[model samples]
Target: MSLRTQLTEILPPLLPSNPSEAIKGTELIRLARLQLNGAYSDASLRYHFSIMSCDPASPIAKVEKGQGYYRRSAPVPALTGAQELLSLSQGRLDDLSSDHEAVDSALERLRKFRAVVTRYYEVNGRFPYVFRQAFAQGASLGNLWKFPEVVLVDWETGDAPDEVFALDPTMLSLKQRLGLPPFRLHAARLRIHPSLASFREDFFQALSASMWAQGGELIYAAPVEDEALADGLRRLNAIFGVGVISFGLTAQALDDLPRAANILNAHPRETEALMDRLQINRIAAPHTRQHIDWQSLDGLRRESEEVQHLIGWLNDCVGKGRAEAFRDEA
Candidate 1:
């Protein structure tokens, strides 16, 4: 089958075959397209093309454009093992990828697709590419990639509870791939579940705009911090009135930005986790300004996209009722 046909077949019936044409050459949405594919990229990978090891120097997969889109080059070859894993998640998709080989193919595609459009609404102000095929096993899942404040626990105070949660690696990779602006997590407190860490990104992103635009004393009506968050979270908990909000999100993907504050307020699990990140234990690192890794700001600037992706996933709970098709990828 044709690449376009394959993309149309496997994708959630909504994506366009000629995304460039449909998006009118926008770079922002180009990232979205990449993520849509990554949404399918998971550790429980379905086929050989879904792996990331194929691209040795860099990661590149066959991106099919319209017919005759390639002037001289041919489509990418069918890969086996890592290459195949890097190619596609589904058999049909792999069959449809490029047969051509190029050193800087992925980089070239990034440049070529610069005209792609992007979305303006801050889906948590964070980028949307952090989740990808190999992300979960990588380095930054849960406490591993937490904010400095998160890692600092008081040896004297007793170790905090270790939190564990599941997420789609490929979807996470998508967040890292497309770096969006940074956002914050406003909540009651922290806990072990990875959801709280994610809350920080989404909560902050929504507030950044509202606070920046409205100039607020902040609504304690919602949970901006962990301790006082519950009163705020219940609003969203009752929304659909079903499923475990802690399992994922109270905020949904297409959820209205205005509603997020309330939805976040409704989901206290994530907020409490944020509070946990902020806790000052007797650990030598200390919460005092002295131990803080202010220098990380530079790195964080570079990683803001990952942060955004985190927020997007966190927010997807209430608005969209889940992360961006991540479980399949993770």
Candidate 2:
């Protein structure tokens, strides 16, 4: 098939996987390369670029001699656009399926992750730990596609008190290699196309990434069209039933970022006291913890949301299964 048609067939039918799956999807890599090649290079209208040969010592010379060179402006950087990338993917995905369940699931999870990040501020009187860590390098979470799992759970949660657990040994190794916790973000984030019938086996281990800055902190960045959502984490507040962790009056204030932060900041003890106030599963995470059984979380969510929740679970578990497959062969 033609590259364009191949792109139309593959890009949008994407599914989320761990870094490995994302990176190894040959079709997506192919499409990304094509989209970049077709629309990115040498597409801009040629602008009249010239160095002005003005008298360096006229009226301007009377003021400052160095001021002239700063005016020798040049065109913008070699242009790179994600529109074709997103559109090409979107078009291909639209043709392949009619499911909205995955879209809703992703949107809801995005919302949940946002709330948790904000709640960390309320509970600790500071931004979420991952946010803080990112800030150390100058960044913040993307508002549009927040990966809640990454910021909340660490590498593993001991539901039965350590020893045995539910994580991909293969993934854990890669994460160790990359200096990241093998946690929720890697486990739950997806490059999903709701209509895509199957998944690529390699998405879980690798993917491209960018970093950003806000409030003097560093955070992970997601690729997309809108840049304004740079810090639009506030959109997360609109998601319902996310931070249901039981913390008494803290729960009362849990819905409010400022109020929650006030309590945590005022009584720094509350941060540590959280375990006493909530269940193991309700544990609050502020950094990149990898262990939240987001797959099981679907069972805990309300019945109305269960269908979509399960869809998300299935999408994520597909990666886990692949990771396990890799582990079994290892």
Candidate 3:
């Protein structure tokens, strides 16, 4: 048997399923050798592990945040997990499998991912505005194409949470005179998986939703491990200017995270602990326009009550001469 074929059979039972307890390359190599039929150098064994880890069909997976390998989870039927959430949100549970446990698991992973994405931006100095109503039950499915789940506002300066940082009147006026908006907004579309079949749909959905924003981003919970999938995403990005990023999170890793509420409300120390688990990779940089498409935004504002609330929040911040994080209650 080929080395890769041999290793495939050898790795799964030997590998840990949890990412936190990932075994180092050397340790794995030593253990893998025990089952080997022929001589193989450490370099050769390590190379096979790295390469095989990228294949979804392969049993081996590399930890994104640390040094080690883990057993990849068996493929879930709805690999992307988006459709499961969509079906549940639309109250079409009957359309899904009779395995309601799997459905609930998918939904929890989706929710946790959203919370992680939100907290990731918050700690990184970008203020996030969530559009819950767009995804709420009874909302039209078309909203997926028309609205981003989150709008990231970069105010250029701020530190304290919910604490206001004064924007200088002089600088604000100067920016206005220069025809530059005081801040930039980038609309983001989040997905739990990256697949060749569905990525184009994912990319264009982000593009369609971000027509009114400065730029657009497509964020994935898992790594863009497949070369073909990565290349396809890059080609689309080159033409469309929408950014692509992978959090290096597998479905299993997301499942290991704290509940969505706990992730969102994590204290600094706890947040850091959570952040350490991520392996962030930027597949393509977003091309941010100098100005937002205000005309398109105005048109949207007329239709979406959520958009109106978003604008109202921004206006409140500007009026107060300080930027504060968006609170659902606020």
Candidate 4:
């Protein structure tokens, strides 16, 4: 058999699926020889490994920022333009498979992660509003460009635990007079995985989704352990100003958590326990602009009822002189 063919056949079982646990090229070569049909030299085998790793169809994949190889998992359903996850859409879910249970589980994980992120930010003093209608089943795919999964609101003065935070009236008035927004708004895109292949889309989507806001964030549920993936995110952040963060929750970790509703309503002690589980990593800090794009925001208000609600909530807070958590009336 050809060396490439031999490696492809023998490598699946030998390679680790997790990028962090990838086997070094030397170790892989040694293991491959046991099942390799012919007596190939180490250098020739290494060359084949390098060449085959670059091919997506090949069984082997070289780690981007390190010396090792791993097994690439199956691709998720996504849009071709930005590779946005379409798993929430009914049409795309049908394309996933006949196994409905697996689909339900994947979606459960996504919701749980979103709940976790919302609560995490809430505890940290940032109010988060979710755009549920945008990603609901049967929702339009183009919503990815127009709306972020979550919008984080940073008040000029506020505290957690209090149902309502008292805004500093003088500061708010001063900021309004100075032509500066009294609060900061950041749009965030959340995902379960951090992959070298899909991160560019993730970053850009966060950037595009936040064009109307003061800043943007790309948050991942899983730990970004791969050095190269982290480096790529940093480089993109440096150029584009969108922040990147990882919550350090693996798929299994998310699965172990309580239901999304339970997570969102966790009490102080319970919330603290949940926070202890996170190994949060801020890959990059987002650049905050002093002014929001009012025109772009107005366009969104016309297209999205959620955006209208958000603006209404903000206006109510400003008028009442208290920054409070958003309560959905619908």
Model 3 C-alpha lDDT per residue in residues 90-194, reported as the tens digit of each score = 222223456778778878988899999999998887889988777775767788888998899987444345444666577667887998888889999988877
**Cα lDDT tens digits for candidate 2, 160-234:** 434333555666667669855344332222222211111111111111110111101112112211111111221
lDDT tens digits, residue span 30-109, model 4: 99899878789999999988777655467777775567988865444542221223622212222545666776687788
Which 10 consecutive residues of model 2 have the lowest summed lDDT?
58-67
Best model number under TM-score: 4
Error of 1 at 59 (Å): 31
All-Cα superposition RMSD per candidate: 23.5, 23.9, 5.8, 4.2
Query: How many clashing residue pairs appear in each of the predictions shown?
Result: 93, 37, 0, 0
Comparing 1 with 4 on lDDT, the higher-scoring candidate is 4
List clashing residue pairs in candidate 4.
none
Cα shift from native, residue 97, model 1 (Å): 14
Off by over 4 Å in 3: 1-84, 87-95, 158-164
Give the per-residue lDDT digits (tens) of candidate 1, residues 151-180.
Answer: 101111112233112233444445446642
Cα lDDT listed for each candidate: 0.25, 0.27, 0.81, 0.81
Clashes of 4: 0
